[model samples]
Target: MPEREILALRQRNAELESRLAQRESDDNLYRFLFDTMDEGFCVIEFFDGPHGPLSDYVHLVANAAYARHAGIANVVGQKLREMVPDEADNWVARYGAVLRTGKPLQFEQELVATGRVLSVTTFRIEPAERRQVAVLFKDVTERRRAEDALQQLNDQLEQRVAEALAERGLFAELVENSVARVQVVDTELRLLAVNHRAVKDFEFLFGHRLKAGDSLPERLANFPAERARSEAMWRRALAGESYIETIEYGRGARLRHFELRFNPLRESSGRITGACLFIYDVTRQVDEQQRRLQAEEALRQAQKMEAVGQLTGGIAHDFNNLLGGMLGAQELLRQRLEQGRLAEIPALLDTAGHSARRAAALVHRLLAFSRRQTLLPQATAVGQLVKDMVVLIHRSVGPAISVQVQCDAQLWPSFIDPPQLESALLNLCINARDALPAGGMIDIKCDNRWLDDSTALALDLPCGPYLCLSVQDNGRGMTQEVQEKAIDPFFTTKPLGQGTGLGLSMAYGFVRQSGGQLQITSSPGAGTRVDLYLPRHGETPIARRPPSEAPAQVQRAAARILLVEDQAALRMVIGDVLEELGHSVERAEHGPAALELLESGYVPQLLISDIGLPAGLDGRQVAERCRARFADLPVLFITGYDQSAAQGDGRLPPRTQVLLKPFELPDLVDRVITLLG
Candidate 1:
């Protein structure tokens, strides 16, 4: 061999040796990678079966990890169906497709034989003709359980979120429809949210609609008078203060009241972010309270008036009796002087006369307070009476007060004592004039009123048609306290010496005695109104007798008279007066004594008896007993406190006359002669 040949041969051998060494190293690295992999790796070979092509696969090679995952050792060269008899056919189908199409696939499955969950990936090995597939898998049973638990938790969380959203919707609906005016405002005083009521109320006050983001100041700018207060309240609330207040808004009939609350809205960190306003209308409630207060005051006034009436009536009755005796004695003494029998004591007689006249005036006042004054009641047109008194009322009230008399065209006639009624009108006018020292208008109105049960009950009067006489004045009105006692005797609002304190009391007594009702309505700074309700006289007005007419003089007659008197002094004076008038008089101390005489057949032509006689049998009873025997007997009643004797619709015997106490001897003689004749 040549030297060249030798060298070439050596190089070829070295190259061969190098190539062999590299192949060995590559094989060792591949074995190490395959054995040390975390995933289980296996190679499968497909074979035809009776059911279909590629129906089964045999494990040709498997890593150590594959043995652990499959739970089978020495699994190489074993068919998958044999190792896992209950395995689903879908496993074979999925591997078969990877082999046939030479595509990679990944899936998760449970191994029944090992009771393990596995994530599997398969791919066909190169060489289209070879029916072989490589599979990589990982045991993932614990990981799958963790994933399932997480999914359940996510589903529960979604359900809770949906419920929370539903609850929020319901709360929003309630706020929107609430009757109370609700609003939310930001720190900048801009409206964030408002309920239906808030919107409506805002529009009613400002005549415009409100929306979110509108400035609160702008909303209240129309009411400049209230804007400052509203702004201050809002600012306080935003500063974390809460407050509630009642605000009066509007004026006159459109006036309204609202209770408003401001509450600070805060964040979780306790910092105030805004304020919430809640408003509620309280107009109706306030009005109702005021009306109830007025009703209570009116009831108190009525009770006071009733108490005064009772007290005065009792006092007047006792005083009348005393006056009767004193007047009677004086009249008897005066008769003696007139006959020229007491000429030597003429100065004493004159002194007695002056005292008697003064005593009569006091008696008149007592009767007026007691509502038992002798009254000559006649039906008179009220409109005409008011027309007649217009001039006098104006003169009494003074020129400062503008007095106006308004009479309805169809004014009803009233049954009242003309003189007493005139006095009451004059008193009312003077009081009204004093009230308006600075000058104002006064209205005197006369009209007809038909009171129903409810109105009558309110006024403490009987239900009927009445003549309503109202005197209204624009003046410094009375307070609630003064109005309550206005009708009580001796209750006066005037200063000392300015008023007698009996003006209203006398008016009240006179009206009550005439079967009428009296009401006074007044309020501070609102002037006063006095209403006089007189009973309607549904008959034609009686023609007034001319004042020039004198009493008819009767011829002296000797008549048998049964005189019943309770007081000894009064009885003696009356008996002497009857005897002086040329009448045969029989006297009794009381009704029983008088009855004894009448029952014993002591018949008298006339019976003059005191109605308030002592004992069980009164003057009326004695007269009744006398009349039983002498049916034609003429009775003349003498009384100081027995006003009932004067009442009745022609029920008494013919020639019956009631002579009030304190009568003159001439008057008594005239009555006796007229009845006897």
Candidate 2:
């Protein structure tokens, strides 16, 4: 053995020892790095299987993180098929492709053993020929869940956006097609959008087309009168105010009206952005209102004129008939006196006086129908009044018609004019007679009634107790139209000259003036009924005096009487009558002369005066003056007019009596004798 060879061997041994120590140190550092990494690390070795090359793999190396993520311990030498049988083939195929192609592959998969999602990057181990793969992976279960949730949220958001766009499209369509003119403007008063109606209206008004971005004020410039108002409205809307107004345009048949509204448009931030204007045509509304008012006024005028004409004509016809009777009777009396027919004088005079009395009654009826007659209201028993008028009603209806009276046992009293009520009842009986040419039953019923709220509303009357006097007739019933106008003056259904038409009108007026209601019900085939609802009187009704057996013989008395009359013929006739009754008479043609005579100490036991004597002082004033001198003087008032003036304040002096004009001479004599007694 040589010494040099020994030395070379020792050196080689030292060098080999150094190289081995460096390799061991590098392997330890790599192992430490692999174990400390956050990502899971593993190395897989592939081999040929029954299917193909690189068909399966075995876990050759695994870091501590890989063990922790895979939820398996000691997995370094385990086959991928053994750990995750279901996914082993898939994983093997993926890693085999990377190993064979020398390409890196990234994918996400689930670990069945731990049920954790993993993001993996696979690459071939160092050498190209090596059928081995190194896997760098992370447990990304939480991140995957978050990404899935985000995707679902995005899908929902897309659906909501699509729905919102569809709704917006529908709203736009509705606005565009609306009948009302609609316009949208920017803050600068420039038009942004307009409905079809607005475009058409603008074109009609300005004779030009309108487009977006056109200034609203400029568009209205052609209508100078409306430009300022339109601008002001836009300004107000821009200031966040809303306004509405109505305006009229054009004239006559071409007239038009518009109701305009200006509304402020706002942004999501609640800031005023622009304005929206709406215009509605109101021409028909305005025209209809005007026409209705005009029609109502015209109807009122027509009703008023009809009432007046009817009243005038009725009064004239009635007066002429009455005057003719009186004039004819007087002419016959005059002829008898000229022929020296003394025996017929009394009968002729009675006939003339009767005609005059009839004329006075006609005047009274006229006044009653006009509602101008002074009525003496009293507590009148309705049942008694109806009973008393039964005979008169039967006479008026004639023998063909039967009259029946039905009254309550304890009938209520009515506050009304007794004479007027009797006249009204008589008129109703006559009307019923006229209705039935062939004849039918007439029924008069009187009863007490309590009107409730509903009843009062139906009758247009106050709620209270009332005395109901109903006159029903089973005769030729009136039609609806006739019933409606039955109470109108001179609205009779009778033939020409057969009916005066004032019967129902007079009764209606009398009943109404006494604070009552008159209701008539009838149909074409049904019977007619007239109901008079009179207000109940608080006081008890006074008992009426029975009829006298015969006229009492007048007792003769001598007394001086002052007679005041306006007409000379009447004064002389009355004076002669008073003298024939054994009373001295002092005559005066007028009120002043009568007063002068009385003032000159011509005192009398009674003062007889015409109520309507002409002059500065009326007959009533003269009588008052005479009474001052003679306190106990009796007064007898004779008048063709109403005695309301003489009965001032609804009362006359004590021992005062009123005798209507054209009274019988015997009745006059009897009154004078009774007053002088």
Candidate 3:
């Protein structure tokens, strides 16, 4: 056998031994990995079963981690039915597909018996004869739960986004379709949003187009006034001051009116970021109101003209009757005097005198109704005045009509003419009596009132305290037409000659002249009420001393009187009358002449002057000039003209008196006597 042959065989034997050792080592490593692997591993062998061919399988082998994942210990050599009989068919059908198709499959399933979830992978063993499948799985329940939760969160977020987009779209639509102009601006006055109406109106008003991101003021730059004003209002809104405004622009045919509402635009966190303006055109409404005001004014003017015409006609008729009476009486007296019938002359003279007195009385009432008569206003206790008249009223109205007087315990004092107020009260009472033809009740009420601004405005009087004296009668009352003209002079409901038509008019005038209002409230069959609201004098009145019933002393000392009359006839007549009264008289035709007499050291005890003089100075001026020299001179102003200044607000000089013209000689003498005393 040779040495070379021995070497070759020895080498081959060593190579075979090395290959066997390496194969054994690889087998041990594979076994160790299979047992300690975290994933559960198993092999299922299929076989013929009761359900049919290859209907079930048994666990041929399982790794150590198989029990932890599948919760089944000693799973090797266990049939699927024996291990989980309730769901054996389900497992067999799932793994049997791998054997029949020879395809690998991967899936996760719950092991109900162990209450564990297993992720399993299976494939058929290589040989068709060997019906087997291998599976690798892990308990993936926690991972599946986390993935489901993430998916739900993603769905909610998507839904929220969709809702937010829908809301924004709705808001935009609302603004665009609004009839009024709507715009939103940032703090920088930049246009953030604007509706179609706002854009169109802005173009119409300022002849400029509007768009988002454009500065509003810049668009109105050419119209400086509108720009400045609009910016001011916007700034206020931006500063958190919400307000409303009415604006008018243009003139005549181009005039337009608009109502604007401004509000601050705020974030959801309540931070003011900008402002919004809403504007509505109200040109038609404004024009209608203006037309209404014009129509009302025209109606007022027409009614005023109608009243004037009525007043004129009434005055002409009354004056003509008085004139005819006086003229007829004078003619009769002249004829009787020519015939030398002294007895008939006295009767004719009496007739003429009676006519003259009636004419004078008519003139005085006319003056009172016109609020032009002389007034010596002083604080008066009107409550006591009304109380004093109750007895007279009761007697005048007869026993048929019941008379009642009610006065406030703390009635406010009033500034008014005492004689005029008494005449007014008596006239009102007499008028009330006439209303109650079948005898009704007459209620007199006097109360204090504090007029607020609204009441004062309605009554056309200043707001303040007032004294209210009312006369109410339960009679037939008056219609609206009659009540409206009830206060008019010479307007009466009674038949001719029975009523003078001056009672209510005189009362109203007297109340008005004393800074008061006269209101008449009446309705058909609701009775009549006349309320006199005189301004409160704000002071307690002095107690009035009762007049003595005794006559004035006839035997009085002579007084030196200065007669400053513009009319020569009046001077002569007045001078002669003073002389007849045993008084010395000096005459002057004008104020300058009278002052000259006074300057020449002729100081008269009384100065009687006409208020409307012909020369440089009037009666008031003459008296003022005369008093400059003779500080204590007593003055008596005689006039038929308006002498409002001397008596207005009761501001007459001390020791001064006023007398209206057409006075009887006796009345003149009485006034002279009183002033001299």
Candidate 4:
């Protein structure tokens, strides 16, 4: 019995010893693993504390990593309240919940003691009644921050997408409701989008429906001209050019005027993407402008007709008055002769002669005012001419009115008739003298003026250099009303019969006819200033005036002459004068008769002819025919026309002389003798 019991006991002891040895080895490995783990690991045991039952914890087993993650050293067997007393309350979510639920809990929280965020997992250990839990955690501060940033980015992207959609909706609404036609096209002229108005207009104009994504060239293929025009404009806009232009569509009554605005679509980098066209109809505006222009033209025509009527009426009244004066004078002469008042014969003849001279002067002035008077323009030294006439002007104005003449140095030469200028000067002085009844001052001045476009327009003359002749008088000035009508025919400010009233009118017309301007500046109680703006001679070289010589006079004897005249009385009187002057005379009633007489071998030493001849030839033609037979024959023109017209705007031909009608008999004789001898 003792041998069997001893063997069983020995086997049991060997088994127990081996089991104890394996257990110790496993414990050592666990300890090594726990100490070397990267994550902080600890075993916490719950206990009753100041907070309440099972409300606090102590670290029963903590690895070396606990200090690295939790920033607390010597954690083994330490109460949480003792290790981190300040942050002990912050871990209220730990151990208690895991122990109650017996489930693993995962959470992230910042360890205020170390100022680091920790990701933590904790669970109740085996046999939960012992009130211990295992906690594993790692620092995750950077990872949590990145996750929060990602969430924010997702929210912002959603909001931006919503805004883009709203903007697109607004753009569509604006295009659909706009009155103008709109189309957006890419650089290749492919339509990206189009409004309803543009589609309708395209269909109406080109008889085809227009749609988005349609190539513009394809839509306008049937209309080659339209395609070319649209393409040209579209290319410019696609090249980043924005502009407004006008376009016409349809024809005649169906035509529409459209204002087109082009805009370019560009990218963020200023790269051109597309072009947009906005077209608005402006047909009504164009039609209105045309109607306004037509109305203006019609109004101008009506004004011209009214002006012509006034001028014609004035001419008839003045002409009849002048004719009556001449007729009355002639009737008185006849009565005196019938009564045989020999002593009064000379006085009656003087009266008739004076009336005749007045009639002639009236005709000349009327012609001047009408701007139909002939002009003989020559480059004249105006300053020298004014100086020469100062003595005459002073005499005409009289000693009571002091006349001051001042001319600018280096004055330009004016192209004008010297006699007419002299006559104009005398007329202006006389007017000034009349104004100066109380004997004021008269200032005659001349200077060169350069008129720019605006100044010339104000003066109603062409822009150029000019010579200004000014006549100023410090006398009783004309009122606004009087100055306005100063250039009108028969308008006068003087007492009855004292002034002809044609002074200003004649001067104004004459100046205008000579390519110049006449301006009057006057105000009541101030003074009157008349300025004559004459065109400067265009030639650069100053004209040197030759010394003037008197016409040569010859003895009136034994000179043969041929005369051609149209009027019966004038012809008879001229023939009698020629015979009395001891000249052989031949006469014809018209140019044809004169030519016929000349063809009959009647070649006289001198040819005298009237300008207003009948039968298809005037004095100029008669002279030509007469001179063909008698070369170098001296020809005398007796005409009512002024020398400006009789010579046809040029110097008279060789061996020619001109005498206007109503010229003195003695002057005529002198002319004739000079030509014949």
Candidate 5:
């Protein structure tokens, strides 16, 4: 040992101590960092073969947190492939890159083995002692879920926005096409949008164009009160309030009712962005209310006319009864005088009798017009009916108007009252003659049709099959105003003395009562067409022949007669008349008395009974009783009431005769001889 060798050795030992201390300090710092880090830390070691190729990944170290997350114990020094087969190959490649390059790498990946999203950073550390890769991983599952939730919310928001926009577009289109006027404005009361109707109407109202950025139109100022109300509404709407109100806008000369609705449009931040104003014009509705009040007035007038008809019908019925007795007695008086030495007075009596017959015929016409006369409704060929009317019409009109028919042979049959229908045809032909003045053509056309529901509804009729009989005239046409009221009773356009106005009205009523409809169409310059729609009927009708014409005459008869009547005045007159006619007569007030007389063995050769009696036994019932007992009794039943009551349900006695009230004395006497003989 020399002195120089000792100093050199001592210097080397100091340097070596310093180097060892620095290495220990660096190791302590790395340990502290690994232990205190919040991030999970793990180290993976890659083994190399002699050929310098990587063999496999081995887990060399893992923090306590990393071990807990892996759900394993003592994972240190375990091969990664053996511990987690699913993540082993991927981690080996990633970690080997870091270890070989010594470059840091960071990426986000999902750990398949743990089903957790993670961000991992890997780097090589401490190459001098042991070669390994250190990886730091942070669980990112909650972050990923939050991002997914935000994305879903964004998608939903976009969908809602699209739906809202589509709804707005639909609303805009509806307002543009609506009869109502519509406008939109911002919170500042500046106009933003206006429907075409609103723009046109406003322009017409204000006499100006409405342009963008323009101030409120001058029309708004005309209605100061409405404008004030509108301003208040807009203020409320801007404050996020919704309201509905009816407003009147006018300039003293023009006025209209507008139903206004105000709504606020809000943004995502809950601030009012604009306002929507919807306006609906209710002028037509307002006008209709006024028309209803006027209609009420007209309805009252119509009711008054209906009351008059009821009263007239009742009076006429009673009058007919009295007339029948007078006519019957006069005929008997005339016949008796002719048989006596006072035959010269018979001519005067015959003249009086003839006047009575005329009055009776007039009563028949009254009953027919009122629709109270008995009708035997049957299916008659419309074309045939029209053709038959032609010859009669020519005579009735006296060659003034030519009667023509344009009917098809295939025209369907209709259910109608033949006699009354014939009378109606006569009345129409007479009217046509008067209208022509210089002669015109009258067309009677028949058609078969099936009216649909829409047409029937518009015509205010039943929806079904029908047969139409149309009467068209080339005479003077009526005005629209006249046609509207054509069916009103006694409302005639002719001169006051020229027409009664009931011809058309009676026809209308008759058609209506028969479950049918009538329509009249006329223009001022064009021809008039009167159409009758009758139900299609199937039952056959009895053939009708042309009417026979004859002068009024009374026939004489002789018999032993039983007369039954409830009215004392009528009973006296009838008994006197029968006695004057060379007949032995017995009188009874009711059916029971007549039956009592018959039961007592006072069998008369003839029975004459008034149909309506107060004893609850009518003339028909008496006839039924008498025929049942005698089986072949000659009976004649007379009535001022409905003839249908005697015929309904086959209630009339078989082989019995009937006389309608207000009959001529000749008709009654003739019926008696015919029945008895």
Candidate 6:
């Protein structure tokens, strides 16, 4: 071989060796990248077929991450439709796009099978050994969720800032226009600006109008202390602190409490520029506090008065019992004396009976004053009720007081105890008569008035329309102090023995128990006016019917009557009254005895039992037991109490009759006859 041929072959062999080494290095680098990449990678193969429908792309290969995300045990050489049939249509479209264009495409989508939101990148990679497209998918759910949450937070912050700005605008307007004193000042404690109230108050105190650049500490002595507190407050506020404080002002001239506020204003640079001061005159609030204290004191006094009233009521109750025994025995003795041969003693016995009757009246008045009297209220016409009391009032006032009534033709009827109203009217008439040295006209009027919301608020009472019954006297009126204490029990300016000082109190209580309000308005020289506001019931008012010329005849009944009373004197008196009415009467001293009497072959047709018995069984329980035995039996109960037990709790049978104690003998007889029939 020649030397030149050897050199050329050697060069060609060296070039071939270098090319082989470089190709091996490139292969190793590609393999490392394909195996170690974090993002999921895969190849999707497509085929063109006659069906014209695209066959689902086949998964030539898938990385471990993408395989696990799809919950696939093994994804190598699997068709996309078989691995994720639900997502096959989407994969086929992307695969076709990549294969047809032989270009890369990128989009974002959520893979439901993997429960992952992914950013996907697909590209056509014409493999040297095979034709296929590689796809890359990366989970981006966390990043997307964080971005959405950040957007929501920004939106909420903007909304809150807008609301705060709105509130600030309103507050600024309020501060500028408010009657309270408001001002803005610099750190040097010079007055920058002030509301009209500040100018007026400061001028009133110092006799000078405050202006900008005015030293506040010199004009107002309180400004020094206020400024000191303001400085400390602003310092803390600018240092990222929030503060709220209340301080007192104007101590020397007049003791007035003003609400003082110190707030800092800042610029965008977060530096404090000035401070705002808000001063509110709390005089009305102070006055309200004082009034509340006074009301509390008055409530305590009222509680004490109530305690005294209870004691007085107990005494009156005992007095009524004594009066009962006395009146019953005296009447019995007088009746016997009238019938007996001891006829000469008739006048003496009559005089004694009159005294006993007076004693009973006194006891009744006492009970009324103590508010212990049981009230029996009924539907009553105001016009007629007032008319019925005219005669008695005329006689009681000794004809000196002329009664004049101006009743509205459409006056609403009232539900009240008739006797109590009569007493109240009579008491007012007498008082009016006494006020006038000579005769005077007493105006008694009833009218319908609606108390709307404003009217009720002015009166400081509940809101509702009510019927008003008013009495006005053309006589000397009481002073303001007297008017204030007029409804207090036993409080009177009259001579001690001349009055018990309970007439108005009883009237007030009766109205209250009737669910009405009693109000009095008077002045020293103006005649007194008393108004009773009662809740109006929407029912037709019944007028008084003319009485029949002849009295109605009594209806007869064969019902036997049981008279159970512990007091012997009352028992005998009641027995006599019942017998005279042509009825068989069986008497028992107590409830147990009455039960025993009934058990011992006495089936009384009616049970009339006294409530207050010495034995254990009360009238209500006796009625209960009797009702249990004979469900349809009629029971007439008489009691000093209000008989609330019979009214409530369904203890008494339906249609049970109850009569208050100390009723007249005639009244009792009439009730018994009515109930029996």
Best by lDDT: 3
**All candidates: TM-score:** 0.34, 0.38, 0.37, 0.36, 0.33, 0.36
How many clashes (backbone atoms < 3 Å, residues ≥3 apart in a chain or on different chains) does model 1 have? 0
Error of 5 at 395 (Å): 3.3
Runs of candidate 3 exceeding 4 Å displacement: 1-169, 288-316, 325-466, 476-535, 539-677
Q: How do the residues 1-677 of candidate 4 rate in per-residue lDDT, one tens digit apiece?
A: 69889999999999999999776543433343345434577778889988888867878877776789888888887787776677776664566888887876767788776778777766566567888777777666655564464343221110001111223332343344344577878789998777777888788788998888999999999899999999999998988788989989999777889988887876546777677787876676577557655654454334223223334554455457667766776787788789886787666666666656655654554344333334567888889888866645655666699989999989888888766676677678778888898899999999989899999999988898999999999988899999889988557887774655666776787688889989999998898999999998965445433212223344456877888887889888888887876788888899888878877877789988988877899888888888788888999998776665567646789888988787667667778877876
Which 10-residue window of candidate 6 scores lowest in summed lDDT? 155-164
For 58-155, candidate 5 gives per-residue lDDT tens digits of 67767665754444678787876677766666776777777777777777777676777766766666452366666666565665664574343221
Compose the digit string of candidate 1's lDDT tens values, residues 1-677.
99999999999999999999876644543453355444577888888876577788898878898888867899899987777756738778798788877767767788776778887766676675778777777676765674474343221110001111223232343344333577778899998777667887788777878888999898788788778888898999899887888998778987889998778876546877677787877776577558655654454344334323433544355446546655665776777778777764555555555455444534443354235335578898878877866755655566678999889998778889875786677678878888898999999999889999999999889998999999999888998899888988657777764555667887899899999988999998899999999999888886644323433455565788888898999889888877766778899998888877867878788889888777887777777788888888899898775355644442555778887776656667667777877
The alpha-carbon lDDT assigned to residue 421 of candidate 2 equals 87
For model 2, residues 433-533, the per-residue Cα lDDT tens digits are 77788988999998889999999889889999998999999887888888889998657787775555667886898899998999999987678999999
Ten consecutive residues with minimal summed lDDT in candidate 2? 155-164
User: Each candidate's lDDT (Cα)?
Assistant: 0.73, 0.73, 0.74, 0.73, 0.66, 0.64
Model 4, global lDDT? 0.73
Tell me the lDDT of model 3 at 289.
58
Q: How close is candidate 5 to the true structure, as a TM-score?
A: 0.33
- lDDT of model 1 at position 538: 80
lDDT of 6 by residue, 1-677 (tens): 99899999999999999999776543432333334334566666676444245566567767666654455666787776666767777777777777777666767787776677776766566542344676666566665674474343221110001111223222232233333466666666676666667887777655678876876666656556655755666556445443455555455656566665555655446676556565666654565557655654454344334433433544455456656766666776777777884755555555555545455444444344334325667777877778755644555555566788877887777787766776677667766777776778788888888888887877555787677878888778999889989988667788754665666786788788887888898887678888877777666555433221222336576457888888898889888767766778999888898888768877777888887788798777777777677777788888765555445463455657877666655567666776676
- In model 6, the Cα lDDT at residue 567 comes to 84
TM-score computed on alpha carbons, candidate 3:
0.37
